[model samples]
Target chain A: MSAPAVAYPDHLRARVDDYLRTLRFPSRAPRTDGLEDAMRYSLLAGGKRIRPVLALATAEAAGVDAPDVLALAASLELIHTYSLIHDDLPAMDDDDLRRGRPTCHVKFGEDVAILAGDALYAEAFQHLLTAQPGEPARLLAAARELAAATGVDGMVGGQFLDVAGVSDTPEDLRRLHALKTGRLIGASVVCVLLLAGVDDEAVVRWRGFAGELGVLFQIVDDILDVTGTDEGLGKPQGSDERHGKRTYVTEYGLQGARSMAAECHRAARDTLSVVAPAGATELEQITDFIFTRTS
Target chain B: MSAPAVAYPDHLRARVDDYLRTLRFPSRAPRTDGLEDAMRYSLLAGGKRIRPVLALATAEAAGVDAPDVLALAASLELIHTYSLIHDDLPAMDDDDLRRGRPTCHVKFGEDVAILAGDALYAEAFQHLLTAQPGEPARLLAAARELAAATGVDGMVGGQFLDVAGVSDTPEDLRRLHALKTGRLIGASVVCVLLLAGVDDEAVVRWRGFAGELGVLFQIVDDILDVTGTDEGLGKPQGSDERHGKRTYVTEYGLQGARSMAAECHRAARDTLSVVAPAGATELEQITDFIFTRTS
Candidate 1:
């Protein structure tokens, strides 16, 4: 059975939505071709603004109300959108739908979709150079963190391992999730710390918290894959089963996955308490929302 | 008739070759599944190593004997390798041969080939964050230059336009080449100026020089496609004709294209004189190589 839907707090969600609506693009003569349009089509497709939200909440928790990092946050989403575009390619997962619309390749040709994804990756880095919440050094650190998370030993490595079908042991499974999803989610939090120029020790503690949150996200996602309908997923249901891909639910069973997510959520909250103590209300609430998101 | 094979400077070739041999891998347990091997396979596959040579030459021309930027130079090759890998994808050019050998997708399978390209991109940026020849600020500038040159208004955009067959005018042709190849070549020189902390005005001058060289490279390439044969060219000749792709030779005729390349080469040498009046023997030689090469 699925848990009741969690209400993500309205204030943070509103800010992210507003920012996404009015996102600035480089001022240049628009191409007659549809490359830029294809980029915008997928970028503006709505989804849970989870990564950006985590960035803002982490910044606030670190005792800074900086918003310059929103550009960084937005760039993060661009990178995320690119990953989705490529991962859905006919050569990859071969998905037909994403975020309730035809995938980029379905809407555009496969060639245009590939270029769109490639352009976004480049754009994300281009934007990162200019987006600084505090000092330029902080921005530089954020860029480094994002690059590391996106590269081998992080998202790309994990994806390679997944496509290789090498995860037989529980340890391999954990390593895969930690690299594939955990690094980027953790980067969202790390960007906030860098924006605030927090202490190294604090960055360490927050990473510990964020790592658990990332695992919690995958565990919940696995559970939802088993429990979710096509409507809730915004794509085909039972994709993991159909593809025969391994997941937390598959390894631990449905109830076991649920229990593991609960354990992780509790552990993540504890680390947050250690790092922020008097703050992190938003972070705490966001943790629960991760467990409860239907799509 | 093809020009005699211009002797590539043995000294520069040796340096790049020595650097590529036993290139360092980040310390980690090697994945047994051959993802790393795929990345290395494409990376070390012999090409001319032109981009790295350009970077090092530009740095030296800027009055810095800075070998430290070799890491940055090396990362430039990584990006170039990635572009080659993707451009050969089954969905893209679908080529089976590159540099007289099987392409990445042909040897590694399409899936790993895709991941290898993606990972190389990420790894390039990750490596860039550490590859400062001067100070951090200069490094930041270098990073920005690289990112912009790679993004929508640069290589990827030009590629989109090329694939879309959008260039019909001379203006469109110039824009296509400038974005596709010129910006990155321009970046190699720009990176050197940044590394040596050269003034902004100098950067503009060097870029003008590099931009002309980039055009010369392409003009000669189109000439080779028309005039050279399968053995000399390595890949099958007349690919542009077979694919019905547009080129300078197609638009201007062989003699006309040769005159244009000579003009650009002369213009580039003039700019090089202004920026590095005391030196640039290699730069001048390479400019001739771009114009006179048979393969």
Candidate 2:
């Protein structure tokens, strides 16, 4: 899980950041003043932007140009943002802080937060639906994939299992994490492949690789919640254990959880070898970063 | 605003009810155990089934057979049910009761309720996406329309405005209700038009008619919320006022609101006459029902 520090070249990272900035809320209609500002409040609050970065990096790795993949990458990030807003509502996780700023509901009230989420989700699909002329079918496929990943059988379903106290076994834990975190990551890679017009075999292999990476990400996140500092993490630490959450850190002890995460990262890197043989060096670098990231 | 009761015929109403029951939750996959049950809980919780009924009735009135329109009608209802479930979450309206029973989140946990809503929303499109192959484009159009209506610019946006607190201006009040309540109803009629495969100028006219009817229906709902009793309405009275919501009744006095509703109902009836010459009588009957209903 360890590799040399290979920072994303400043120019490429800057372009990714620029794409993210364009993904913020559109200005509100004159009749609906303040709506855009509310939406932007949560969206602009800093975080890794990992999902979009994954989309772009994978698309580039698959030979798609940066300009061709920017919208798709932003769409993935919008979907991720919407999920965070809804998840933080008082009914769900009820958190006030997200990314070291007030959660959507806390800043704009639950109604606006809910609407903001709905808007972001819709905008994500709209972005896909109205993609470049030659990209309609691919966009539609991406939209369908995203809808399935975020809806009943995916993120929402995983949340249900989590809150229902159903993730008692390792299999249940895997199912929860796969749907909760893995599907979006998987879809991000799949979207890149679709955009790049990659072969089905490569698409499937990439999805498998991304899914493993997603689970590893979640496992590492759980570990961070226990071992990381609040300043470093940008959100509360130890809340998972406090909330009686069924994280890997809770199900397995700290050392066991660390070992499980390392194994997952190794499996992810192994999967990536088949999917991106030409980009294997970069994939390994990402794996190493995920394994060791403090936040 | 008043008219004598005109039966829809027991056979027709019973047929629609039966169709709704079957469509409540599509047969679940083995892994979707609790998801199926959570969806069914609210879908089966009886209301007038107004949205689905409106869809089916409009289709039949436009010359499509009721059975032929069943899936489309059911899809519309699923969206409505999903909205209700999400709306009742503790983060939203937080009502414990709906349709004389405990709300989904009250009966199930918040997470299940959220999943149920997401599943129902997903299933609505899933049903449309997998519709019988007669009119794939129409199905796709309807799915897209449903997505737009339920997302930010329609129901969700209206909800945002509602929660943000509107002023006493009549126009502001109307805008709020139009989004919150009118759009889904408009979508219902649009679904019928799409499913019926109607392409005449009549489609445009009926959409206009349905949009006005949706506004009228919402105004009547506001009046009822303030004036109707628990037994008649199946929920608490004045709940909107209790929440400090700005409704038609709040912005205008009772008499003023009633007069506005009457005018809208008449306009709706007039538009229906232009759109559905064959079904004008039935459409007018529905308008009358909306204007005079206790709930």
lDDT score for residue B272 of model 2:
83
Candidate 2 error regions (>4 Å): A1-17, A23-31, A131-137, A194-202, A280-285, B8-20, B23-35, B61-69, B131-140, B192-204, B278-285
Docking class of 1: medium
Model 1 residue B238 lDDT score: 92
Please, what are the lDDT tens digits per residue for candidate 1 over residues B1-295?
Answer: 3557666665775687777665643313235247777888888887777778888777677767747778777778888888888888877778888888888889988878887888888888888885554576778888889988887777788777777778888778778878878878888778878878899888888888989988988888888998888777777899888878889999999999988988988898898899888978777777777778887
DockQ-based CAPRI category assigned to the predicted complex of candidate 2: acceptable
What is the CA-based DockQ of model 2?
A: 0.35
What is the C-alpha lDDT profile of model 2 across B1-295, one tens digit per residue?
2445554433445665687677634221225567778898898887767777777678668777777777777777788888898788777788888988889988888777876887777676656555523354565556667766765567766776766675447777777667778888988888778756788576788779888988889888989998888877777888998888877787787888899888998898888877877664555666777877777
Query: What's the true lDDT of residue B225 in model 2?
Result: 93
lDDT of each: 0.81, 0.73
Tell me the interface RMSD of model 2, in angstroms: 3.5
Location of the lowest summed lDDT over 10 successive residues in candidate 2 chain B: B23-32
